[model samples]
Target: MNTSASHDPNCIFCKIIAGQIPSKKVCEDEQVYAFHDINPWAPVHFMLVPKAHISSMAQLGQEHAALMGHIMTLAPRLALEQGCNPYPDGGFRVVVNTGAEGGQEVQHLHVHVMGGPRPWAKG
Candidate 1:
């Protein structure tokens, strides 16, 4: 959760998780949904969103931390699904953008798993 869905009635990420806005589904559970980013920055850029709309990491508590742990544990697996590898020439990056200053555009809590061969290469 990086932005404030609490105030946005038309938040796209929220609608996607709620099944109101469709997206390229990747991984999902009762707690979260992971999908490819519509506008990708890396070879692999997928977002893992919690089904519960919690706005920002600052609002997170012990319960949310536990859920966050679960999200991290799945990040690597999700990255692999997007073709990320962890070898010398293959690996991935996991990121959680917290606010506008952190480059977050969505308000709902989500994790970004991105990488692949030469994933970190600068073009």
Candidate 2:
């Protein structure tokens, strides 16, 4: 939808946002795209990705505050909708891998929302 300079043509997440790649979508809006992870580490594992192609968390600025907030706030709701339980005992993990050392495989900025029964093999 947003074919602007903010989008990276080569980025996988961008491709998914642009419908260039197939994804098990959870939800989508003008600012964000949420989808099930191909290799989930938990029973309910999905990602919240901004449509704009920011490379990583290190690149975030004041301009992205609202977007980040929206993502964070949306996580729990989406997590619950995706089968994560309520709260207290039922919770989720929000992960943002910053760079290579941080274990980020994709260059595009995204938030990983993992929840549901644990004892997951990996994350």
By TM-score, the best candidate is 2
TM-score of 1: 0.83
User: Any runs in candidate 1 off by more than 4 Å, and if so which?
Assistant: 1-9, 119-123
Which residue pairs clash in candidate 2?
Answer: none
Please report how far candidate 2 places residue 39 from its true position, in Å: 0.2
What's model 1's lDDT at 7?
31
Model 1: per-residue Cα lDDT at residue 81 = 68
Q: Count clashing residue pairs per candidate.
A: 5, 0
lDDT of each: 0.76, 0.90
Best by lDDT: 2
| Candidate 2 Cα outliers beyond 4 Å, as residue runs | 1-5, 121-123
Model 1, span 14-96: residue lDDT tens: 78877787799999987788888897878888999887777767668766777888898888877776788765667787778
